[model samples]
Target: MSKFKNLVVNLSLTLGGLFMGVIIGEIGLRVASIEGYQKIGDFVDSAPTSFHTAHPDLGWKLKPGASGEWKGEGASFVRVNSNGLRDDREHTKAKPPNTLRVAVLGDSFTEAIHVPVEQTFWSKLERKLGNCAAVKGRKNVEVLNLGVQGYGTGQQLMMLRKKVWDYNPDIVVLAFFTGNDVINNSPKLEYDLYRPFFVYNASGKLVPDMSFRKLAPLDRNQRAVSFVDRLPSWLVNNSRILQVAKKADLDLKKRQISKDFTVLRANNFNPPKDAVWDNAWRVTEDLIVTMRNEVVQKNADFLLVVVGDPIQVNRDPQRRNKFMQENKIQDLFYPDKRLEKLGNREGFRVLTLAEQFKGYTEKFQVCVHGFDNSVPCGGHWNEIGHRLASIKISQNLCQQLKQSQLPKR
Candidate 1:
C-alpha cells in the first residue's frame, strides 16, 4: 500500500511538471516573437498588425515598393472618405454643393488594390469631372468606392443595399469583372483566397454559412491546425516539396476527377449549362432590379459597367482552353460566348480591354492596360491593368454625366 501511494504521488508530480512546462513554454514563445502571433480579424481588416492605427479605408496590403502620396505600387487610385470628401464645408470648385455623388462598386479591380489613392480610376474620374465648369459650381461629383476584393455582382448589390445607398449618391456605377465572379458564388471550403462563406436565402436575405459560423467557434483549434498546414506550404513552397505536392495533387485529381469542364467547375455542378447560367444571371438580374427599385425609391441614377478579365478581354478564344489545360481547371459557365452575348443584350455597358487595346502589344506582351507584361499572379488585374480600366471608366462616366444635362428630345 505504501509502494502504491508512492507510485501515485510520483505519477501526479510528473504530470504536473509536464503541464507546467507546457504552460511555461507557450508563454515564452508568445513573448519571444511578437510576429509569430496573429491578431484576430487580421484577415478581414487587411492589415496583420496594429488595427487601431491602420487606415480603415485601405485594408489590404499594397504591393511592394509602392510610394507617392497619391499612388502606390499596386494600387491605381486614392480613396477619400467623407472627412476628406470635401475641401471645405461649403464644397470647393472641384466638389460643388448639390453635385451628383457617384458611387463605384465592384471587386478588387474596381477597388484598385496595391495602388495609391489618387491613381484609382475613380480618383482620375473625379479629377476629370471636377474640370467641368458648367455644373462645377452648381453641383459636385463625389465618387465613393465601396469595393471589396472577391465580391461578385450579387455581393456588390447586397453591399449597395446595405451600405452604399445610405450615402445618397446620385449615380451608382456597377463595375463587373468576368474572371472568377461566377465561381465565387458557389459554396466552397477555401476561405482565405476567396470571400468568406455567405448564402442568399429564397427571400434574398444574405446569411452567413452555418458551417462558417461553426468554424468560428473552433478558431483556436483551427489556428493550431493552420500552423501545421502552413508548415507544409512553407517548406514545400520554398523547396522540392511544393513541386512534388503540386505534381501529386495534379496527377491524383486528374485520375480521380472527370476532365469535364462543366462538371468539375463549380461546387454545385450537376445542373445543365442553361440552368447554371440562367440561375446566376437571374440572381444578378434580381439584384440589379432590386437596386433599380431602391434607386427609384431614393431617386438615384443607375449605370452598369461590364469589365472583362484579361483572359476574357483578350478574347483569344483559345486562351480559356489553354488555361484549362495548364491549370487543370474546368471552364464551367464562363468562357461561354453565349453568356457574353446575353450580358450585352441585357443592356450591360460592356468594356472589354481586348476590344479597347487591340494590337498594342505587337512588340511587347503588354496587356491593353499598359502595366508590366506578366500574366496575373492570382486571377486579378495587375496595377497597370487597373489603371487602364480606371481611365476608360472615368472617361465614359464623364460623358454620361454631360449627356444627362442635354435636353431630352
Candidate 2:
C-alpha cells in the first residue's frame, strides 16, 4: 500500500514539475516577444520611412490605401494600376492602342530604390523609347519592372522562369549587378528560403519551395524548423546576421556550404587558384545552359547585360588591385574573361557599363553603396544615378534593336 502511494506521489510530482516548466517557458517566450516588440518599436522610431515600410512591426505609421492613394509613413505616393503595370500616379502608362511589353529583371538596381516609379530606369526607358517614332504609334512599349530588391542570379533566374515567363514579354532585359549577386547565390547561416519561394516544378506548376538545396539527411522536425526560420520578414530583416556569418564562414565554407556557393564564387568572382573555381564554373555553366535552353525552348531571345560596380572602374585601379594583391583574388568580372569571350564566342549581347558611367562617381563622394549628400549608403543607385544608368542602358538597347533589324550576313 505504502509503495503504491509513494509511486503515485512521485508521478504526481514529476507531472507537476513538467507542467510548471511548460508554464514558465510559455511566460518566458511571451516576455521575449514583448521585448522584441519594444526593440522593433525603437528601431522603427529611429529608421527612415522607407525602412519603416520595409519593417512595419517597428512602430511605423500606417496609412492604408484609400481611393487609390497608398500613403504610408515614408512614402508620399499612391499605388495605381497603370496598364497592367502597377506604378505611381505621376508615371502614367504608355498611351495604349500601342503596347510593347518589355520585362526588366535583376536585383535592387533593376528595382530602382530611393526613386519614384516614374524615375525608375524602366519608366524612364519606356518614356525615352516610347517617344521614338519607330516604337511610337506602334503600340506603346510597356516596360515591366519585375526587379525585386536583394535577388541574386539564381533568384532572378527562378523569378524569370516562374513569374516573368508567363508575361510573354517582347524583350527581357537582365541587369546583372556584379557586386553581391555572387554572394547572394551562396548559402549562409540564415538562408532566405522565402525569396525564391515559388518555383516552376517539373509539372509546369508554380509551387512553394525553399530556395536552398535540400539535405536528404535532415529529419522532418529539422526541415520544419528550417522552414519556420526562413520566413520572409524573419530572414530579410535579420540579413545582417547572415552577412556577418558569411564573412566569417570562409574557413568552413567548403565542407559545410552548398555546392552553389563554390560555383557562384568561382564563376562570378575571382577565387583563389587552389579554390574550387573549376567546380564553380561547372555549376554556373550548367545553370547558364539550363537557363539558355529554357529561353530557347520558349523561343525568347536571351540577352545578358553584364553590369559591374563602381569598384570595377574606379580611378584607383589599386582599389581592387589591393584585394587581388593581398588575397590573390582574381577579378570575378573577368572570370576567364568568360563574360566578354562568351559575347564574342556565342553571340550573346553583353553591355559593360562600368566605364560608361565611371565619371559620375565623382559627383558623389562615396562609390558603390554610400550616401552622396545625405542619402543612405547602400549599393542601390540614387535617383540621379538610376536615371543615368537607365539612359545608358536605353542607348544600348536602342543600338541592339537597330542591330537586330539589320539584314543578317
Candidate 3:
C-alpha cells in the first residue's frame, strides 16, 4: 500500500512539474517576441482572416467604402469604392465620350488586397493607358477592377451579371488562376462556407446554386458572438509563447503528414475532381462563352489571361522540383497552353504571363507576393509581380485597342 501511494505521488508530481515548466516556457517565449511565434492573421485584419458582407450571388464582397489598415505578408492601406471595387476612384454610369473602358474580372490575383491601390495592375494599367490615350488623342481609358478574393469562376460569372456590365466597358479582361480554381467549381464540402459554387447537372450542364447557407456575418450588436470567431486564435496568438508552441506543433504535424501527403495538384482537390473539376473544363468553357457573348452584345472585346501560380514560377529548385514531381507536372506551360487552346477554339485572344515572367525571372527572383521568398512559401503576388503584370497587360492592351480602333482599315 505504501509503494502504491509513493508511485501515485511521483506520477502526480512529475505531471505537475511538466505543466509548470510549460507555463514558464510559454511566458518566456512571449516576453522575448521570438521569431516565427506570431500568427499571420494577427498582423492583418482583412478578408480570409476576417469576414466581409455576404452576398447570396457572389458569396462575399467588401463593404463599399470600406477602408482598413492592412498588415499581412504585405501591408498596405486598402480602400473600396462605393461600387464594391478596391479602387480609389468612383465610376459613373456614363463613360466619357472618346474614352476606352476595360473591366477586369477574377479572384485575388486581380483583387490584390495585399498591395496598395496605386500599385495594383489595373490602377497602374489605367495610368499607363492614360498616357497612351493622350498620345492617341483618346479622351480617357478606364479599367474597372471587379475582383473579389476567393471567388470561383462561377461566382465571377455571377458577378459579371449582377454588377459589372453597368460600367459599359469597351474591353473585358478575365484573369484565370490555375491553383485552386479547378476545385472551386463545385460546392461539395465546406465550400458553402467559402463561396457560392456550381455543380454539374444530369444533362452535364453547369448549374449554379447558392442553396447552401453561408455563415451568418458577425453581428455588431452581439459583441460576444462576434468576438467568438476570433477569441480562440486571439488568445493563443496574443501570447507569443503559445504561438511558438502552436507553430512548432503545426510544423511537426505537417512533416508527419507530408510523408503520406498526396499533392492535391492544380487539379486534384480529390473528390472535387468529379464534384468540382470533372465539369470544370466544360463549365469554364460555357461560362467564358456566355461571358463573352454578354460582353460582345454590348460591343466589347473579351480577352482572357491565364495567371501562373507561384509554384509554376518559383525559382527555388527544391520547392519547384517537389511540386513538379508530386503533381506529375511535366510542362510548366501546361495551364497556359490549355487555356490558349480553349481561347483559340472560342476565337478569343488568350495571353499568359508564364513566358513573360520567365524572361524577367532569368534576371530576378520571380516569387509569390509575400514578406518572404524562401522555400515552402507563398501563393500570392507582391507589388513587383503586380507591376510586371501591369506593364505586360498594359502594353498589349494598348496595342490591341489601337489596332482595333484603326478606322476599320
Candidate 4:
C-alpha cells in the first residue's frame, strides 16, 4: 500500500506539471502577435454556410449563403449567395433582357475575399462595361464571378459545365494566375488533393481523377476537418505549442514539394526539363483549350486573362531586376507570352496583364498587391490592384466585343 501510494503521487505530479506547462504555453501564444491562430487544425470547414464545404462533385465549394469576415492581407466581410458565388445577390440562370452577361473564372484572385464585393475586378468591370459600347443595345451588364479559392484549371472547367452554362453568358473570361495554377493542375506537384485533377492516360489523352472523394477524412486533408481539427477552437486558437507544431509540419511538406515544384522560379518562365513539369504544362494548356472550345460552341467569346503575380509587378526596379538575374530569365513575361501564343494558336483572344502592371509599377512606384499584414508587395491584389485590373480588362474586353460584331439582343 505504501509503494502504490508513492507511485500514484509521482504520476500525479508529472501530469500536473505538464498541465501547468501547457496552460502557460497557451497564454503565451495568445499574448504574442502571431496571425491566423484564432482558427486552427484545418484550413477549411465542412459545415453548411461555412467558408467551404465538401462537394459530391467539385471536391469543395464556397458554402452557399455563407457569411464571414476574411482576414490576412486585408479584412472584408465575405457573403456567398445561394448559388455559392461571393456576390451581393443571387444570379438567375436566365440572362435578363437587355443585359449583357460576362462570366469570370479563376481561383482566389477572382473570388477576392481580400476586398469588398463591390471592389472586386469583376464587379468593377460590370460598372465599366455598362458604360462602354461593347453591348450597343444592352442597357445593363452583369459580370458573374464563378471563382473559388484554391481552384485550378481542371476545377474551373468543371464549374464552366456544372454551373456556368446554365447562366448563358455572352463572354467567358478565364483569369489565369500563373503563380501556382501550373502546380495546381498537376497531382504530383499540388499538395492539396481534395479537388478534381486531370491526368494523361495511356493514349496521351487527359482523363479525370476523382479518387480524392474515396479517401478517408484524414487522408484528404481538405474538404472535411479530421479528429485533430475538432480540438476546441478556443484551445487550438490559444495554444502556442500547437500553432508552432502545425506550422513546422506545413513548412516541411512545402519544402519537400518545392524540391521539384518551385513557385515563381525560373522553371515557370523557362521550358520544363522533366516529365512531371512537362505533363503539368500540357494538362494546363489542354484544360484551357477545352474551356475555350466549350464556350465557343455556345456562341460565347472566350478570353484568357494572364493575371500578373506580385513579384512580377514589384514597384522597385532593383528587386524586379535582381529576381530576373537570379532566375536567369531575360523576360519576366515569359509565361504570359507563352499563354498568349497558345490563345493565338487556339483562336481565342488573350490579354497579358503582367507587362501593363509592371509598367504601371515602374511609372508610379505604387504597390497594387499585398495587404497590411502580409509581406511587402506579396499576396493578392489590394483595392488599387483590383481597380487597375478592372480598367485594363474592361478596355481589352470592349475592344474584343466590338471586333466580334456581337448582335444586339
lDDT of each: 0.51, 0.52, 0.69, 0.82
Stronger candidate by lDDT (1 vs 4): 4
Clashes of 3: 3
Q: Whose lDDT is higher: candidate 3's or candidate 4's?
A: 4
By TM-score, the better pick of 2 and 4 is 4
Question: Candidate 1 on 1-409: residue-level lDDT in tens?
Answer: 9999999999999999987886676566456642222222323333222211122223222232222332232333333333223111222324345767778887766655455556567766776666665456766667777666556665666667666756777778877654555555544322232233345788876553434322331151231223223443445443333334445554555554434423334322223356655455455555655565666677776666656545434434466467656555454334344345544665444444444533343334554432333334334555555566667766766676678788999
lDDT of 3 at 123: 86
Task: Tell me the number of clashing residue pairs for each predicted model.
Answer: 17, 7, 3, 0
lDDT tens readout by residue for model 3, 219-240: 2112112222344766755665
Measured against the true structure, the TM-scores of the candidates, in listed sequence, are: 0.58, 0.58, 0.73, 0.81
> For model 2, what is the alpha-carbon lDDT of residue 226?
30
Q: What are the runs in model 3 whose C-alpha is more than 4 Å off?
A: 1-51, 133-135, 189-194, 200-205, 214-262, 266-276, 366-368, 372-377, 407-409
TM-score rank order: 4, 3, 2, 1
Q: What digit string (tens of lDDT, one per residue) describes model 4 on residues 1-409?
A: 9999999999999999999998887677668855332334334443223577878778889888889887765778999999989898889999998878999999999999989998899999998987788575666899999988889999999999999999999999999997888888987777677778988789987778888777654556432332334567676566677656556656665566555444434567767769988889999999999999999899998889998878789889898788778778787777898898898898888988888998998899888898888767878999989999999999998887787676767
Poorest lDDT segment (10 consecutive residues) of candidate 4: 40-49
Deviating ranges (above 4 Å) for candidate 1: 1-96, 131-138, 188-281, 313-321, 324-354, 357-365, 368-379
Predicted candidate 2: what Cα RMSD to the true structure?
A: 10.4
How well is each residue in 135-230 modelled by candidate 2, as lDDT tens digits?
A: 666656777776655665665677676667666766777777765554454433113332332334697544434623332212212312332233
